[model samples]
Target: MRVRPFAVALMTAALTPATLMSCKPSSPPADGAQPPAADAGPSSTQTDTAFAALSKRFLDEGLALNPVSATQIGEHRHDSEIDDLSEAGRNKAIAWNKAMLAELGKLDIQALSRENQVDALIMRNNLEGSLWDSETMQSWAWDPQVYSGLAGGAIYNLMAREFAPMPERLKSATARMEKLPALLAQARENLDPARVPKTHAETVAKQNKGVLSLIDTFITPNAGQLTGEDRKRMDAAIETTRKAVEEHQQWLDGTLVPNAKGEFRIGAERYDQKLKFSLNSSLSRAEIKQRAEAELKRVREEMYKVAQTVLKDKPGAPELPDAPTPDQQQKAIEAALELAYADKPGREEVVDFAKHTLDVATKFTHEKDLVTVPDDPVKIILMPEFQRGVSVAYCDSPGPLDKGLDTYYAISPIPEDWTDTQVYSFLREYNKRLIHVLTIHEAMPGHYLEGVHSSKFPSTLRAVLRSGVFAEGWAVYTERMMADAGYMDNDPLFRLMQLKFYARAVANAILDQGLHVDNWTKEQAMDLMVKQTFQQEREAEGKWVRAQLSSGQLATYFVGAQEHFDTRKAWEAKLGDKFDLKQYHDKVLSYGAPPVRFVRQLMLQEPIQ
Candidate 1:
């Protein structure tokens, strides 16, 4: 149920299924089955060390092929690069993942200490299963996150960072152009037409439009500067892709658009496999459904109390208010955003605000002796073009391998040339819960500072298996954590309103997965957001679309937060006066973002590396 607006970048425009993903050609794993190997020689601890080194190699391959991921993690080697779309590059990555898996599978997990063994097994299964999913699941074929994120990263990296020189940027763009035709062709060939989710196809169409705009706005003029044959080559390449992109759009509108036949659910079989590999356990579908429903109810009661606290001023706020009219809904959403962000400064003012937020929170945390603050400072960057066309904001952590890199609390600006209607639509949608809860999620003792410590973890495998649950959980947990820390010490209303948004995200995880995988209706989903969670219309609508494209994600917020909170409570009971906040936080983040279960084990005096 963990759903968040931001993770990867997204594209805007219709696309022919032909123009599939632009990077990581390594196709998903072959058949969801792993080829068995004899257990490695020696004990569990030795095996864990071998597997950790193996996973590091896998991460290196990921960075080499997908440079944008590297840049996000603070790797500058490929800062101005776009990945090769040729079959050769894709095949190489695929081969690399496979080989890494083979080498890793040879290790014996039974020999390692419990904590190291847990991480080892998670890393091993993660790599092998991911390799399987890469080829078999065909996630990039229609998953909007895959498509949008790939394209979005391209745009954002080009626009957002000045990490590389202009020449390097232009060269990468030029090189990218040369690979476009082949890239599109391979995409079509590798992506099975039958597998795309109807939701994915539709989302991609809209996402593609935004991506196409980049060519006219950024690439054409930028690339036009190259001399001689290079200029001719780049321009011709651009023109060719431009025409192809139009055809791609036409294909989406005319063919895939009309013929898209996809189901949001992966069915019980694939879902189980995903639970095993992606989540690092054998959690059954029934188990997740049960867990989701239980959490849903618990979060709802919390939301109701929060709503009463914040919206008591609104006459008969109707518990949850999804306006029947779109306009009314949009207005409600707008009002919600305004309420949540009452204390924060605008995007341009956020860096200072980031520091100030930490200082303010640290003051209380120090006084109350809550969790300790991370030592490294973080900065807020304006959202890059690559990450545009999606959420309002996200906290981007530095890469595991990179040193002295800044953590980015990226805030996306409104599109500069948009019409007033569009601008207002965006603001209206981003209303209260969206902004306030996100601030707590992305800043303060949330992602930015947390990341600085996570990046320094000793376990390389632990770093790679950064749990989406823990990452999102910690962020969501912080929304409440701040309130408890007296975030709006002066204005309790702000704290209450923020809780409503946090609840909305909590509901999102349940409703998102329920709708996609369990046949929950839109009315049901909307009701949860409006009445139970208090989402504004525009934000709620966005959530609907986001939920369709995403499943098994929204739950990370509540689940991770709950686990984090529980762990802290346990530590306090165990250590009493010895449970220093600084030591506690440092300990929690020390194992990187492993699944909460693994983190729990690590916290119980278990060996992580």
Candidate 2:
């Protein structure tokens, strides 16, 4: 989410005595005579005042409608309310967006400061995206993840943090839980079984079941703290919510799964629209695919060279190939990747390994002056069960309003029931060096670092309307940046692992488009992952499921990294020797997580697109 200029202005007004002084009377007005009726005519300050007022109203009203988002961002005002999942609710959101857009159109962008112009654009894009999602995309009609996420996040958000007293939060959780059954009922009423995709149904089923973990692990333990009446009510609500989740799971398995014959693909037309909204970039889908394809090849070739370095002395290692065939490249790359895979941490040590890696990455980041490391604390924790099966690792940053709070670097442990092969595949894919890369991407200079900087941007809208591309792109970019800086003494294994991640980024774009747009089969997708990117079978299979389960998101990594790379190159060209990597990074992130295109315009003083 982008920051709102009004919040920034308010913070400035509150903190800067000079700003307050400037607003006061320059001299006493005739010992009690009115301070000379304030200058009411149009002025630069008036423009800011007008925009700030509009920005705040827009944000405040917007948050009211999207209470789930409000809660996620650490705003407690609507913690007890569940999002309206009814048809009327959808219409209301659409109407609200329309009204906001109309109001935004009235703002004089040219009259506003550069920062406000950026804020206005971010707000406009967000509103437009929302309208598009509701009207054209109609995800509510087909996507079960929407409801499941709300269901799970409703309780998870309240329980995961100490944003409020535990009892207060528990009270809110009970309120939300009491409403859970109806929300699930609304999901059944709202979702079109004929339109629901099988992958979505399966994923949501898993998530719905996982919600019980929240009750068991967090809510149940804390319920004891409540007095008798409150405790009884809370217990009853939990029991009811658990039953609702179980019933939903049963429906998912019995009814939804059987009827989920719909295609997961949004097709090219919707994909293009949604992709534009998701990326907020000037590059077209074709352009992104072109860049990704090139990068894929380049990264693969680089991986081959690194493989050659790692395996040069090993007997029977595949001969160094000068322009090897795809099969030969895969063979060689896998051979070298084994060196990293051989050093895997025990299953129990994943979190500890990530913790140690965070320390090392931070130390190297500061020692090399990569970017200013914030003193903001970060902790490594197991990903909650409900959030599992979506992605293996994530950086769960505190809401922008929840500054200085601990950011969770969540690593999903291997499922206990997995077969030996599955376990091996998981470990090999996340090999020790790659875990370092993961730590760099999810913590240190990745999401956690960027999030900390974004929280201080002073604009609520900017923090709320954060660009996924910028966030994911910066994280992906850091993997390469760290590798380029010779972290781990420039070990070929680490560099190989870094390049593999780059390949995965490229593969992500390819897999997303290929599956959702090109209708690539699981075999074809797996071939690309295993053969081209050297992903293990289990990793490739999980990615296949993920690709089916999502769209456009996978492309963000490659597209965003390219934008970051291009922006850096342009800045370097413009500034010549004056360009500094650390300064550039700090400056880029200083604007919060606006789209890279906006960042480029701001950095270069170009017109906002």
Per residue, candidate 2 scores C-alpha lDDT tens digits across 344-451 of 888777767877898899999999998887865677789876555444577776665554466677887767777777667778778788889988988878877877
Residues 473-558, candidate 1, lDDT per residue (tens digit)?
A: 77777777777767666764565566565666568556746675668788988887876566656677778876777555555565
Model 2, global lDDT: 0.75
Candidate 1 TM-score versus the reference: 0.76
Error of 1 at 93 (Å): 5.9
**lDDT for model 1:** 0.56
Candidate 1 off by > 4 Å:
1-53, 60-99, 110-119, 140-159, 192-194, 215-233, 281-288, 303-369, 374-376, 384-392, 412-436, 606-609
Score residue 288 of candidate 2 by CA lDDT: 85
